[model samples]
Target: MKFNFLAKEKNTVVNYENAVAFPLTPDYELYAAVVTTSLNASFYEKDTTRLERIKDLIQKSNPVFVAKLAVYARNEMHMRSVPLVLIVELAKIYSGDSLISKMITQVIQRADEITELLAYYQMANERNGVKKLNRLSKQIQKGLANSFNKFDEYQFAKYNRDGAVKLKDALFLVHLKAKDEAQQVLFNKIVNDALQTPYTWETELSKVGQLKYYNEAEKQKAFTQKWEELIDSNKIGYMALLRNLRNIVEANVSRYHISKVCDYLSNEKAVANSKQLPFRFLAAYRELKELNSKYVPMILDALEEAVMASAQNIKGFDVSTSVVIACDVSGSMQKNISPKSKIMLYDIGLMLGMLLQSRCKDVVSGMFGDRWKIINMPKRAILSNVNEYYKREGEVGYSTNGYLVLEDLIKRNEIVDKVMLFTDVQMWNSNMTKDSFAYSWNRYKAIAPNAKLYLFDLAGYGQTPINVEKNDVYLIAGWSDKVFDVLNALDDKNSALNYINRIEL
Candidate 1:
């Protein structure tokens, strides 16, 4: 199943032809790659062709891709780069239709960063011709009325004075440092209102009280008092509880509070209701455990339970096909997937392999680097299995021997319906030949002519091991579960290109 919209070229170069090969690349990976490259601009700043290729891909992407890109940029990449390039590319593709409007609305509703929200609004108002400034102002005003915070106040005043709007009622609820008489009046009113509000552990309102007092000693006293109250309450929101535990030392909270937080963090009902991805919980647990080994004893059981529950929620595919999941654990994969992330590409590959394994009934798993070996994946929690596989890093070696896996499978004469490789797609033979993957894949095709190769590119290096234009080969990039959506799209005769071309207005 070949997607008609993909590039027809057989080259490995990063050009416009190769750029559009995977338009459905996960939104998170696409933005992460672009932002990562942009931050390290010194390397690709002079490489206009590569940059333009990425921009071209963004411009030609479908609404679903564009919408997800907008959300990712505003949320995940908010504090990274300006996203001006992406915004420009989005303007070229988005026409402020109902779909794009809904996308913008979703972004605005979830965006918390002032700078990113402003940028989003500017894009909607200037490029897409959507009159959103007034709507956003009203939303901000209502938010301030319901739950006022220092951050919201700061943004409100900043944007208000910048001519975004000056809601007289909400403006008076915050304090501004501006010299304008009107601004001063609003700021003073906000300070007075904040001081009047009762300080408690109800929400973040106590933090607002501390901010309103504007005295270091008074703020510290209030914060400590609030922490004391919270400890006695013995109840905390799931996310806030995790955050508090993460910053236990700085929080200066009690061990009793820490214990209670851990209890909630591991609570089976809460964990099940959290709906967080198992991989994410595992990653957070690993970081927290490393930060303070003491946390391990308290939270490890809950983390494992959460992981198992999350695994139960995963819906496996009903495809009756034999599958091979090959993961790349080479030295190159040790580097973080993005500069802002601590997660390495190897972690992503492992997680993705586990996810695919969960969805497939007849699947064989293998890990390859300098050599290839068939892995007997244990039936256990996904995180535990991934950790066990990770512990064998030394045995797999550091070189990328991707072809060996296919070659070994061919030798075994295994009848495979599909072969999926989770990698950066930068495959090179031990002998330094570029055609190792291609050569081995060709040989496998001769034996299993109906088999298809799905390259799950974890890193968007913009190079593929095989010519993606080939009917038997497919390329998908990203670290999102939605990558599985490609499977449904593939079942159709037109592949993912049909959905991409649906032209939803």
Candidate 2:
């Protein structure tokens, strides 16, 4: 939908001519749009104008979202180079927000370049109005100790000795000496230990055997014994298990070993302790399904239990409003949002649609592209329903005809309290009709006068098919499930604006 008040004004009168120009996007929407669109050049490289507009928006948007965008880029997208630009821009707008310090630590932990880490530390020091010697030393030590790359370890140590010392006061050297001594000891141990290689679930299990000296045959026996002890001991955390599922399968351990690991990882106690999201469990299920290993069934069953257990933490909407979730499964959605990431826009749309459906008692879920049809989702687990929906409808069409969703619902005389369309907002009427989305929306409005349409934009196309001001339509964009958290505030008449203003700086 067009936001007319955001246009650059030539006079006091509203600039209707520049209505299609860049509008004042809400902080959440801007953050979501930029973070998702910035993942790859495929989205922005083709449309330089949209890219420039987003960049301009970032320069003027709130710094809180800027920090959030940077964290999302690093943690969620696994990005290295792209987030640096945002981090640099964020440093320019820094105003002593503690969030910036957290972002700095994340960057230091994940960044490959020592120079980038140093730059972030300098910014942190400036914001805190003091050289944070202890904090910086701890962050550096943590990064070095956790690093799997030899080069990164060396670089972090080198920076700690040469670069960090120069930036700090002479009094800081006392603490630095202690940190240095600890680092040297840790580094020597890491280098001398053969089992201190990349720490994975399997590797951690192997470490148990390395705890004591033993012959080859004796070590094998000890490993088996220790593996069972560790499994039964409940020492392995859920994140360790979730991230290293492949390692566990490829270890070729006995079925009993695998079953025990799965049982502990997916148990209610572990799920509650780990605080893993339902979508993360769903993602794990998808990965295991693709592997098609012998343990797939067992792992899926365990993960299903974990997902159900974790669902209690997700606060579903308490409103008694009928809802319909229309997901876009068009060709554009197949494009990867991030480089080397298997998660595409289509996968995210489906997952979010199913997530919303799972939260609602009366919700109609459907997929749309060139055509539209109601999906018959069974009352089962969330991931099961998603898999079943995909199996029933192999693939939706290519073109993004979002209008067809409203049209089909209107034709069937199915008036819902709300229609949530998860799409890129690049809707076209394949029927060669004018204003098809608007036409169908108006017709639906005739029947359901109070019904609202929420267009969840996965891609930042900067355009919409319907006029939001004239119709009860709202736009929310982002890649994370946090985007859904704004729905409660959206129930107000002001929509996202109210939520944006209420966001803590």
Candidate 3:
């Protein structure tokens, strides 16, 4: 028998599209909101709206669960900003014990996050205009003070530059007793602005950028050499390398360095260690592809290998289990995920949909908008398939007609073990009848009794496109490849909240 978990009936809420949908429980809502955020505006919601919704959810959800989610998002999911936001928001109302301080130690993984947390604390507590931070949250101050021990003088100096809340400001705000005489001296340096400048990727690049060249070709040559030097010195990080592939290509870096890049990118261990969201590879691929450089093919091959490496742990089923992956290429999905990003929500859907397709042995994948048309795809060429879908998304007009996927399957009397919909989950039916996604799902389930539906929520608008509580349906939220791990837990009769609850604080 399939794993079945039950919960109290969830109330309905009208989504941004004015469609009837099921509202997620507070913990589920918080997970969705936290994981899918880049702390920026999505298609239908502004940044402030998203922040307010998260704050309100934190106010109502269990404090322990909220703390665990913050740690999970930071350490496991490899998110930076949202986890800090979770800690800050949680601190505004929760101080029953050392939970806030412990959460800070767990969530603030990097030195820069120390300042970031304080900045957020300042903003959230409305202490921006105040001359002194005497009224800062004591729990937060304790957390920040403990956090200072995790970094060294050079690490602290790197991010101590100008910002809303400087590292020095944080030093004064949290009067941490130094762990040792050396640490005390480092703290003194932090306050006196006398820390030595550490040689880093940023510092090296800044030095190169200060040089003046005689002509455009000379300037290009200088940059090309600098990039090669950085690569040779191993100063460029995995993520930095991914984001700068286009720069490397444009600067006409040597083929030898390009080979090193491809080698590093394709290394499975490096890919896993980077903890980059799958969309980052897609963004790099898309940008590099537009350059029309000969190295595009080499870099694209490396990226394809990297993304597939990242997908190695995605759960799969036997050939007997039939699956269909449907992606939403609706109009709203065309909007970029962030203000300065070229990656769109639909791109994420396509990348993840295509990645899942690569893992499944027996699967039919296609995109849905005004209509759902099945497209045969190769299992190995994940990024290529996503590009194919991106090029042809316009073929089906943009109307969010997700029901058509099921409606077509029902008409054909096809029985699939699983139907996965990668979408923003703002699904609406203009023909609002039994043909809606929910109604169509009910009809389809009746024909195929063991069928289950999974919604891969890309935008996390806090509402399901269909009722998820009663049906054998599941919702997985996030832009990371790690989100797919939830599938195995779900098959073991675990809910998302259960998954978060299992996180040991």
Models sorted by lDDT, best on top:
3, 2, 1
Candidate 1 lDDT over 275-311, as tens digits, reads 4433466576666666644545666566656555544
**Which 10-residue window of candidate 3 scores lowest in summed lDDT?**
1-10
Could you tell me the TM-score of candidate 1? 0.65
- Residue 123 in model 2: shift from native, Å? 15
Look at candidate 1 and give me any clashing residue pairs. 173-190, 174-190, 175-187
Candidate 2 regions off by >4 Å? 1-29, 35-38, 42-54, 64-85, 93-237, 254-256, 264-280, 290-294, 314-319, 392-395, 467-470, 494-505
Per-residue error (Å), model 3, residue 156:
2.0
The positional error of residue 100 in candidate 1, measured at the CA in angstroms, is: 4.6
Could you report the Cα RMSD, in angstroms, for every candidate shown? 8.6, 8.1, 3.5
Residue-level lDDT tens digits of model 3 in 140-207: 88888888888987788777768877788888888788888998899889888898998777787788
Per-prediction backbone clash count = 3, 0, 0
Give lDDT for model 3.
0.86
Mark the 10 consecutive residues where model 1 has the least summed lDDT. Answer: 15-24
**What's the residue-level lDDT of 137 in candidate 1?**
39
Per-residue error (Å), model 2, residue 84: 5.7
Q: After superposition, how far is residue 114 of candidate 1 from its true place, in Å?
A: 6.3
